[model samples]
Target: MTRTVTLCEVGPRDGLQMARGRMATGTKLRWIGQLAAAGLKEIEVGSFVSPRAIPQMADTGEVVRGALAIKGLTVCALACNLKGAIAAHEAGAHVLAIPISVSDTHSHANVNKGTDAQVEMVRSIVDWVRAQPRPMRIDAATATAFGCSMEGDVPLDRVVQVAAALAATGVDRIALADTVGYAHPALVRDTVRAVQDAIGDRLHKLHLHDTLGLGLANALAGLEQGIREFDSCLAGLGGCPFAPGASGNIVTEDLAFMLESMGHRTGIDLPALLAARALLRESLPDEPMRSGVAAAGIPRTFHPAALAA
Candidate 1:
């Protein structure tokens, strides 16, 4: 069977969080609306981290509420701890992703917790989420599952162990992330297979970054491994504000165009996705934007707009 894929737009959260300038809430909502109109079914709207840590997400509650109004969109948000998880729940996030770095050093530096502590946090968050009156999905993303910037070449056993530990938390789903873009294609395939072996059907999404320009390559490898869900940003909008020279997450428009042209259905209209990139450019003029399809322009043979016109 040819597996279908789901593109979960992370531009609103991951893209904007690490950006230089903050995007207005209305503009964020507008961009989100454009993404929905482009046929995206799921979007990571914002993070519940401290406003002091990531001021760009100060208005996460507002964004979540606005996103909730959009029918059929599974609005997700990142939460690092139990506190952030509760905030996500209160903000009405349909799905809450808790990131736990695999490397002990990275985990400590990023979440101020050791590996075990982070696992405990996930446990608490899972329990808290299940107690909510309204149903909400929890996805635990093993950040730096392949490699880490602070700690290079994280061992495969470590990543597998973390996934195993997170599974004990009873999360609705689990995802592996190359948070620093340190992952190569082979490593992506191998690690994804490892995690999937440990968690089976619970392994649902892959979050990749373009730091080394292999975002698409890694994504393809994961797809070949039967990963149906992917996380991407519009116009490649974000990078680690603290980690200079790192590019943003994988470009959603480019990824969608690639998949659809290859006879894979993403349910997204390529032309509409490109138009949404224009809105992002207009909003953040100074921010550097990047995308294969947006820059190269669609070929004449792939006239998506002509059919719609």
Candidate 2:
């Protein structure tokens, strides 16, 4: 078997949610298609939050429906509660990720509820999904797992506790997210190990941000900790509005280069990914997009065996 890495493209939701302008349903579908064409096996198409709360994601259902047409790809959507989960499941998303903010302050700001309340809601959400005729996959992501911008450094134990809580909810996966980008390499390694110890193999994913410029370093730490699935945004566009000083997510193009250079197969075509990023930049002209590989260009000397195939 070829050693592989899964890169979950989150630009369609996390990246676009905070942008200056909203993308039409047709445009969002076009972007999802481009990402799927570039060989990304999974894409976070959009979120199922209330339109009044997040107007940008109002068309998430349509985006998921359209993205389902792409062959050999998984469509995912973000949902914070039972209501949103139903929408995502009804929209036919293959996976629905619920962000369980570890910080009470961030949690209150994000969903108008604290961490305890958030945990209490998980079982209800899971039960409701199970009752559905075709329940979608669930991923309980521990957002702000690292240091919360609102509440200094979060204890490793707290992060692990939340992961355990999510695991008890019968979620399919649990991902640790550096929502504010405040983690160092050691923290990532230790936290991942602890989460695994608490929740077993359910700790398979990491969602990182480049806010403090440690995105790649943390990702390297995660890989060393046996993590394979990563969440990144195209052109590094996104931020947590509630988390002060938060920046865009880890850059997908740059991350793909890093992973491929290290002999891991990601199945993403560098040229095709750049083309997709260009289209995104064109669509959101005013939205700031960042990609080290995009700005500096890929080194001609670097070629991975996976890309050659």
On TM-score, the leading prediction is 2
| lDDT of candidate 2 at residue 278, scale 0 to 100 | 69
lDDT (tens digit, per residue) of candidate 1 on 206-268? 999999889999999998898889999988877664344566899998888767666567888
Q: Against the hidden reference, what TM-scores do the models get?
A: 0.95, 0.97
What residue runs in model 2 are displaced by over 4 Å at the alpha carbon?
A: 307-309
Query: Considering only N, C-alpha and C atoms within 3 Å, which residue pairs clash in candidate 2?
Result: none
Taking every candidate in turn, the Cα RMSD to the unseen true structure, in Å, is 2.4, 1.3
What are the per-residue Cα lDDT tens digits for candidate 2 across 1-309? 246999999999999888899888898888888888888999999999988877999989988999999999999999999899888998899999999999988999999999888987988888888988896889989999999998998988999888998899888899999999999999998999889889889998999999989999999999988899999999999987688899999999999999988878999988899899867877889999888889999899778649555
lDDT (CA) per prediction: 0.86, 0.90
Q: Alpha-carbon error at 260 in model 1, in Å? A: 0.8
User: Deviation in angstroms for 181 in model 2?
Assistant: 0.8
lDDT of model 2 at position 26: 92
